[model samples]
Target: MAVSLTASGAAPQPDDAATELRARVERFVRTRVIPQESVLDAGGPAAGAALRELRSLARTEGLWALPLPAELGGGGLPFSVYAQLAEAEGASDHGPAALGSATLLDVTMLARHAGTRVRERYLEPLVSGEIRTCYAMTEADVPGTDPLLTGTRGGYAADGGWRITGRKWFTSGAGAADLVTVLARTSGAPGDREGLSLLLVPTDSPGFRIVRELPVLGAAGQYEIELDDVRVPGDHLIGEAGRALAVAGERLALGRTLRCLRWLGQAQRAFDLMCARAATRSGSRGALADHQLVQQHVFDALLALRTTRPLVHEAVALIAAGQDARTEVGLAKVAAARMLQQVTDSAIQVHGAAGLGPDTPLPALFRGGRAARILDGPDELHITTVARRILRDYGPQAVTPG
Candidate 1:
């Protein structure tokens, strides 16, 4: 396929290796992953069966533990290369959806913070899919957005272990997780980034209790948890105390990027649906495709996706080269979220109410589109982070490059 450049940035050009990888992953998504999407949405045994199938398939294809470095037996592709496969996965509703508990993002965070021993024990199983992990970062109540009013607290225990006490909510994939990684203030004063610590806890351990699952906008839900003085060996601590949040912030960026690419896939799917409907749906000017207004919306959605695709490419290139992409990645997150949201909204509007019904895929696609807005720090926070950097480096000439 001859694809043109999307934005002012370079095109989404993949090396031979990346191209091959993308094709392989695309095949997996089509033949194996997408089938799981329906089973997962069905819940119960269907979901479990889907998970079993996906894990086995992912392992057989050697598509497991994608984000880990090559030394760790991962594909070691650049984030850009990863984006291509992720976008393809998300393009279909199935995302090659998961059967077992825990998000891949949670597993990645473990690779970033867990100690070597911890990595050998839990990390290996997690990468190998023997054990699943979930990130318990969101809190129930407090100024968690700012961290000044966090209710989660952690303290060193007498037995050289640590005890964490707090209530957490909106933890994705927590219900069936085997290993739960969480964040709490261990020593730092209020608002101090230094006091926060990331603890790796076992779900079956005493004091670690899952409260309940709360329905999100879509079919899958997030679980609320209460960590009551959860105790773990000192070795359970991920990285040095107070560094977890910082490390998490950095790691979360990767998670956000992966999610953005997923939205790209979903948006593409939505666009395909919109195009198909437009081709056959009757309108005053004959088919909807012949209507000027319909054409405008269709063109706009494609153009927006086209432009946003390259921003992601640029971010990937920077990251692959070992360059810091704090600004560009944040920018991509914001843009992708906005573009996908607009694209899906337009698709629904064009579909005329039928898009809003469960009879069609547009409804779920639209709901999933909503997550792009806040799944990664939200657009505002990421924009602010980008803005601050621009100002800090350029003095009074702090104009955002976007």
Candidate 2:
């Protein structure tokens, strides 16, 4: 309701509603969500119970799905305003999922491209936290950098439905998902970008099977799965046939931008931890904060956080305005990811061996920081792609933003 902001990421001055929403999210995450993060990380009946209770509390407190469409039972905050709150909501890895904003990308994609029947069946439940979904695009041995080499194939079945056969790995939350949005080649040959399409496949489909758990750096979330002729209705196709890349590209741009913002939140969390440790913990030379080396860590972490915030918010602004944001998003993605790793690493150093242990969240934060660089198109990919795009304009007209 009445969402407004000053320069997107800058501190809000006049928007009471926006500021209030942000404060509420920060308070909820710091007080309610962060406390239960360890329980959620442990993964068991208690974790599940804690998560359900937290989700219930989120709804009770009116903090659920603030970034989704109001018609779909969310608070309907625009991207610009939500971008600010995203930092707060993203302080914890579980924040978005707990508050329901985790569905933003999928919901946006489905709302724009999915058929009426598919939307009617899934959107409401997804937003209300009644069901969970995951995206499947990467293949077992194929490099994820090129979607044109997708090994998954979807073809028409004798029953007039679509049959999908593929092997996918690194599918996050696949083990517990009720549905999965799969990318498959419908008519394209190898190395051809055309003919790829997105399909909505129910996890309960007759031929769908989970092969194994893919633990990233020893964490339990991603999975490897096999779809052996899993079939779905004709209307389950997302967007136009042969245009999945365009649809996916749109989703990915926003998804990457959102991720950058979340990384900033996480970096800030790490920075806070580092500062607290530096101020209180003492060595033979006195408090850690009093040392020049420790102060350098604080200064460098602060500089990174400050510099990366504007780049991220610039990308957010472009996306909110529905403009080309590839350049901005690419820059933000790499910057925010590295910042997270740097800040978290510094934080771990300040804590000494204690950071590696499970006593605090530093170990998990550091792990995620390392993983962030590789996920959602690695830092190398973004750097090279953005550089290439910028260079191509030098031969002719000057470069324009994308």
Candidate 3:
């Protein structure tokens, strides 16, 4: 999966097939997916129907699961190439789910770490979109900033199984997920990093239940779930015992990188909307585009989009080649999140009253933009972590002794 770079250290241009696939995905998102945003916004049975229809169309169009493995009914595109398509596919929030790439993180993690039985049972159906999954790590009372604070407990059952008991909130898609990958303390006490383990618990398990819907900005999907001694066989473990954080670290790295690319795509969408609004909407003097302040918005949004893209792609390159890219991914994640918020806010400004209304997608995009800052690690955490990592590179000689 090594990528070839030019003399200037830039990645080589994508081949024709990759370029063609990207174009097809862009067109699909623009045409088929964008039109259904209103339905998705509404939520409920109609939205579910629309999503299923979109997924069927994606399959019929030969664009389903482009980033997953071909043997498992995916396009098998490499991350380096799929990174480009991810931006396009991510333009609509529902794009990844509809096209089957939504399972990339879970599928990849399970394929590499899950035991044979777990893989045999879940992998193919997951790839084919027959079932759904969600990751549960954050808890109701704990600061998600630290994984070492996880309080969920998983103990050995009398019959060589495991019994899990804990309550996890803000678990996205928990209502619809067939399986939830839960992080539990297997041996050590809270704050001990050596004892955490991941257990794959089926939603239909005896004691697993969704407590309530935890909405974000009046949107539904996130839920508070409780596992009251939920039991699963011993083989349900993901990766080695007491090494859940290590497995989670790898998963989050790729997940964050994908989120960065998707945020850029959403920002680009907002930028386009802003420019279109500026050029056409007549104000007191002339079209909004004539205003110097409006011009500044255009310039700033374009600058942020263009500049942030390279940082994201840099992270993508390193990740595709299986290299350490913590700094690059952190930089991309923060930059893209801020860029989306800024660009979407500017777009809302241009549209004025209409942007705040439900008629346009600006409000929904804005909500996602704002949440992007908090999800997948907050901006402050990334800023702090990235700084510490960079400083460590300078070693002892660069450190000043007090």
Candidate 4:
């Protein structure tokens, strides 16, 4: 089925092509990816080889990098179309990476702000999956959600480069990344938003070190990195100096939106598992599905999954249109994160002891759901941000007591 492109170059309505693409992704995740969860979770050369094989198959099948442009060796689909397809891919945690489409956020950011030399050096390799990159902005002593508290500093070096010094934690995928985008203060004091700048640092650079892996919910992907006088060329700065906040914000908006969609997919997966279990498992009374309490669990999980999906898509539409979606993104982020967590927890309860074990994907999904709320900015931070922005419109009249 050929997906017809709308006049605005967007997939405003799902077409045959979009439906076909989504079906292919769903099949790939269900048949190919989910079955290998155990091997993938084991984490070694065999796991790495398995992922490489999957990527090869994805490429051969023309399902690789659907979110990227054709010039970059992708399917050239717009974000709106990609969001719908991403839900299918999100059924497995490794779906995007295995399909070689995980670089969307980094690629977009670099395309917009990276210097010519930087782009020439990294862009193709990144898009082609030859190298991996990580974003480092959060610090050990600072809350990443609040960029004003950033403590890493980059000073001018005598050799016409920047000498960076600081420690960053929660740099996801840093242990295996080829490059990292580090946020450091170049001018002004800590707590000042104006002086932060983003510098691209190669993982092998002198004085750049991976301090340790900071596991999330017992998973080992995030890392703590230390930069002790790490030096990079003056051209390594992304966009204008002391403007890291602006550049980082662009990436975060898209990142958060993608995450929300992935969470929705996971939630849907858990919901399916829950319903299947309810239909088969029998208690003294009858099948678990016959119990009112179990039926309630099914209903609530479905409700959460059904409701949060559109909120996420709403944010995606705004982002694809190049419009400000802070409020919408915040709303979707909080809702989807909580929805995933709630639905996963209920699913685990339905599965009884089986859910906590490796027999099912519930444990992994539960851990990811818990981390979703905290990563990419915590729920409280997003709640306050959205509330503050919304209240500003009401003025003094809304705040005044009756």
How well does candidate 4 score on lDDT at residue 366? Answer: 96
List model 1 lDDT by residue over 1-402, tens digit each.
222334565646666776787787777776776555666776788787777778677767777656556665555555555666778767765553441112456556666667777877875566556666777777767544575556689998999999989988888778878888788898867777688888889999899888888777856658999988888889888878877767776666666666667778888878988899899899566888888888999999999998888777777666656678788889889898888888888899989988888666677777777776777567788888899887797665566566
lDDT of 1: 0.74
Runs off by more than 4 Å, candidate 2 = 1-14, 396-402
Off-target runs (Cα >4 Å) in candidate 1 are 1-8, 66-76, 93-108, 283-285, 393-402
**If the candidates were sorted by their lDDT against the true structure, best first, what order would they fall in?**
3, 2, 4, 1
Off by over 4 Å in 3: 1-12, 398-402
Between prediction 3 and prediction 4, the one with superior TM-score is: 3
Question: Which tens-of-lDDT digit does each residue in 119-214 have in candidate 4?
Answer: 888888887889999999888787667788888889999988999999999998898899999999999997887998999999999999999988
How many backbone clashes can be found in candidate 1? 5
| Clash pairs detected, candidate 2 | 326-402
Given candidate 2, what's the lDDT at residue 144?
Answer: 83
The digit string of per-residue lDDT tens for model 2 on 1-402 reads: 453335655433327777787899999999999999988987879988998999999999999999999999998988888887999999999999999999998899999999999999999999999999999999878998888899999998898889999999999999889999999999969788799999999999999999999889988889999999999999999999888999999999999999988988889999999999999999787988999999999999999999898888888878898999999999999998999999999999989998889888888888888999999999899999999998888756776556
Clash number for each model? 5, 1, 0, 0
Q: How far out, in Å, is residue 140 in model 3?
A: 1.6
TM-score of each: 0.89, 0.96, 0.96, 0.95
Better of 2 and 4 by lDDT: 2
The residue pairs in collision within model 4 are none
